[model samples]
Target: MKKQFFYIVLMGLVAPLASCNDFLDMEPMSEITPEDYYQTVDQVEEFTNQLYADILTTHGSYSSTFEIDKDTDNQPSTETPGNKYDNTGQWKVSMDNSSWSWTNIRNVNYGIEVITENYENGTITGDETSLKQYLGELHFLRAYAYFSMLQKWGDLPILTQAFNDDEATLVEASKRSPRNEVARFILKDLDLAAKYMTPDFETSHTRISQDCAYLMKSRVALFEGSWLTNFKDTPFVPNGNGWPGTAKDYNKDYQFPAGGIDQEAQFFFQEAVKSAELVAEKYKNSLTRNTGITPQSVSDVNDYFYMFGDDDMSTYPDVLLWREYNKGLGITNHLEVIVQGGYDVTRSMVDCFLMEDGRPVYNSSIPYDDQTIAKARSNRDPRLVAFMKQPGQINYFINEDYPADHARKDEAFPPLDVGDGTVNRSLTGYRIRKGGSFDKARCDQWNSYTGSIVFRATEALLNYIEAEYMLTRNIQAGHILEYWKLIREAAGFTGAAADPQTTNTYTSIDKEKADWGAYTAGKLLTDVTLYNIRRERRCELMAEGLRWMDLIRWRALDQMCKTPYHVEGFRLWDVMQNEYDLEPADYDGGNDAFVTPPSRGQYIIAYENIQEKSNLYRDGLHWMMAHYLEPLPIKQFLLTSSDHADVELSPLYQNPYWPLVADSPAEQ
Candidate 1:
């Protein structure tokens, strides 16, 4: 995997900027210069393959982002931070570095440039169909790089035809494009890509196929449409042009578009559904649930969850795309399950699952917000049990003897002996199982090889259902209920369908199959659909680090920024009184001569270290516009052309919400 990433970067073909002095250039010691590389089909194919490798080179999966997105009200960090408050140890913070982004963009654009040049010159010729297919793949990658930039920085400079010295000269003066325009450009590229891409799943687990393109289109469309419609307070334009430079006060008031939420949202959602359906038509796949598996056929539903346990593609065909991990490549052993001593899913998200009856767990008659956790979770969606672990649930698989003594394996336990007790050690008792391999013994490293799940069949189904729900309120008519049934069956649940409806919308359920209540009643598909997708996304792409982007796009960061899970118990002990019949020390309020109580097992120890809950959820405040878009760096802003300078720059550089650098003096 590392070599694959390195080869892509090293193999990139970028002609150096025009030389100034001939003697200074010398016979440049270069490895297969760009001039000789783009003259053949094989060369182009190799170059594109290397470019795909760049995706693996940049930051390891979404692990960094997940720390900030999932470790708050939505969920808490399962692992206690060695240092609190200065919890920069989380996932996304590491991604804030400017260099990583530039390198990634450079690699992707370089690939695009080579492919485009060959295609234009007619220098590369292959089986016509195969050539077109490969071209589609190249376009898809370039689009993906731009999309990532858009997600992170909102609007970025559009560098479409690749950047050589001349393009660089122009780009150096180019400012940021509006997010709306950038999104439009991405969609255009994808539209062209879809036309040429091979409409099939890749035979190899890690290669991008045609379906991947559609999945990306669906994702980008939904993101833009949702943000434009739902985030009204942060309109794309103030007056006629984009973002007016009037308001200096972050607190004064921020407003986007009014219809960006209600009516306008429906249009984009409809488009999202169309793209999703296209992928499903081509892939012919769906997420398999527990209902189909017999108890005797497999050990449990968990067996299905660990489908990607081995990186050996020879054995596992379920994984669509991945980066291979080899032990010989200096791979070190470290648990890849991010939840163990890192961030975990939020509790609010736990409650976000729909009930067995198709109602939100919150809709239960009981006051879910109160302390009745067991009741709040009772009768909830069965997926919750499959995804999360609560106390008393027997989770075997720790130091059990393998091969000879597989049956005697002991359940792994979380570290609970922190100075502050086990309460803060790991907030969520449950650890994530997604992307974790059970066959670690075969690989030299424990589980260091990380492979990203770029696209899967399940997401296609989700996209289809989300679109269906938006177009028609009636789950039955919209076919939303059917998809829910498919998901439930795949997860091993079987029962009457859940069909719920809203009174205001006059939503109706077929009287014969009122069982489909869950979908009929689900409104704004934003939360329900978001929740459904989030769970599968989390479970499917655990260590690959995809969950963090979803959190940002949905503006769920505030909800996931604080510690969300804490263990609570009654205070039951003081210091010890005596030791081995030694004389007692002088009594003091802060005396060291104290002891814990004998009934320690029964006594409760309150853990204030619960996951910090988010105050930014609901009311759409999570979707606020400040971090919605990233600002160009101060240097770029200054050099931008006058036309772009007229457009508003991000306030972040001027007055950052989060400090860009740590104070050196404070550290001392």
Candidate 2:
């Protein structure tokens, strides 16, 4: 059935491709000499434009990895009916090996190699310093691709040049490099690129800037260092790369490959701290801060979160890197998949946050039932209110209930305007409002239509806070508090500017202090602050494609999956379909087509407590392996070196050294 669907979709796309070619064939294109191609600044400008397009094509909205990895934005309903596969319920498989492969690497290398060769051969000459700058941009882009590769597949073949089909076929079976080696290579490229790139956003969204290179380096170094040092128990080794049959190389490797878990942790943490500090200091002007007049109302709502909203861009005080959503080049549409029922906010994450006094609400000290939970939720972080709308709150569009489908939309629609129902509201009793638009004239029914793709300075600050808190508890406490203060101030919390819609719980104070020292290495900030940081991350980055990676790195999928599942609630008065005198045509919205109900009068919104055997929390871990990693193409594995049979495994299929299982092989 899935195969049939794939073929049908693929076939449907052919007509558009044919139409595109027809138009392109008639358009007269410019002919250029090698000298003219990179000669003047104008040609260089065009090259940068093409580079941006490349980045967008590979890493932008269309990136499957990004979509699959982040559990926040779900797969389109058209793609996954009933939203069953979307919750990432399936196990990892080796399908689409070509899609997961490092095919893009060669193209990036080719572009860089060509640009660099031209500059070196004196085919294109300008200010020698600026020429190096152009070269730096290319290097940064190439480095970016490799960094992405290392993250996806810990150790992979580091192909430096573009390979022809013949060359690819002729080359001896290559072994994967160690992750550490890949990290070192990436850093070297980034550092070299930094020298030539300028720290500006003027050229194009795709061009490499110094700040962007630094930003990328900091993020890469932090994740690599943190994950390697911390993930010791798993198949992952801390200091060295995972390539088969090679002594760890520290210099050529990312770090000095000598330390054990603790030693590596300290080293990586130190690097993360240093890199984060550099980006923070250098890009102070790029921070996202609220410029609104109501200081108090907006102080706790980070400008960074709002930066994605159309009206909030000019207010971002610190925006270092951003992708352009251009209508001019016919790339205006931002393809994002948003679930109407708060599908991204897993039940587990909802339970993880503490009450206003920084005490876990789930603890025995508090009541575990609905009433207490509702009251406790009020006293929590200000960002929570910014992100979710509770049962009774009014926003742009009042989400009456968490209905399962459009069938409930018709049932919930009241003859006299009032409310949907009492029991069927959001389970957390909340709906998302962050990415929502405030344009009274336009209502946001389809997601991709909202705001821009923004990268803010708050993320840099948050990264620093996480690194620092992990390293030292006492000394970094003050710094962590300072960063939080900045975040709060910028988010619009305080006296007069306080939003009327903001959670009253922001003002609710907790008098008692609960113990978290035992759970978090005795770090003061590690307890409440850690959860707050995560909450902030969720609130700010929700539906922006960061949740899944956060879950993986934190290894919290097991906990997150346990979160409650609730559809928008709809009140049911009867079971008969004919009572309303409605026909099938009256029920069709065309927007929500996959969803249906058990009967006509029954509201599909409320989560009927059906005793299903499957549990989200227990099953969540399976998604990590299945959706996060794509298996190595079986055909490619067959082409591997005979001596290194184990190397054929894809990270998704199993760890590199695991014995191959026939049922789990890519062929199956």
Report the number of the highest-lDDT candidate.
1
C-alpha lDDT of residue 432 in model 1: 37
State, as a TM-score between 0 and 1, how close model 1 is to the true structure.
0.65
* Global Cα RMSD, each model: 10.0, 10.5
Compose the digit string of candidate 1's lDDT tens values, residues 1-668.
Answer: 11111111111212242344421122121244456665666665666676675654222433332344343334444433212223232222221236225555555555566656777777766665666766777777778877777776664556653333232344342434545557767877788777876655356655566667777788887776655543444433221123432333441243333333454456567767888777665544335443222111124545344543434443333344555555578433333434223234433345445555544443443233313233434555555544443333333343223332112122233332243442234333333334444332432224445444445566666667655654674556554656555655555555542332321122222211111111211122323443443444443344444444554455443221332322222122222111123222311111232211233332221222221232111111111123434333333322232333422432322211322232211110
In candidate 2 the C-alpha lDDT for residue 666 amounts to: 23
Question: Each model's C-alpha lDDT?
Answer: 0.43, 0.43
lDDT tens digits, residues 420-529, model 2?
53222232222344443332222322223333443456666667766776678432453565564455556545542232112222322231112111122112223444
Candidate 1, residue 444: the lDDT equals: 24
Angstrom error of the Cα, residue 348, model 2: value is 3.9
TM-score of 2: 0.65
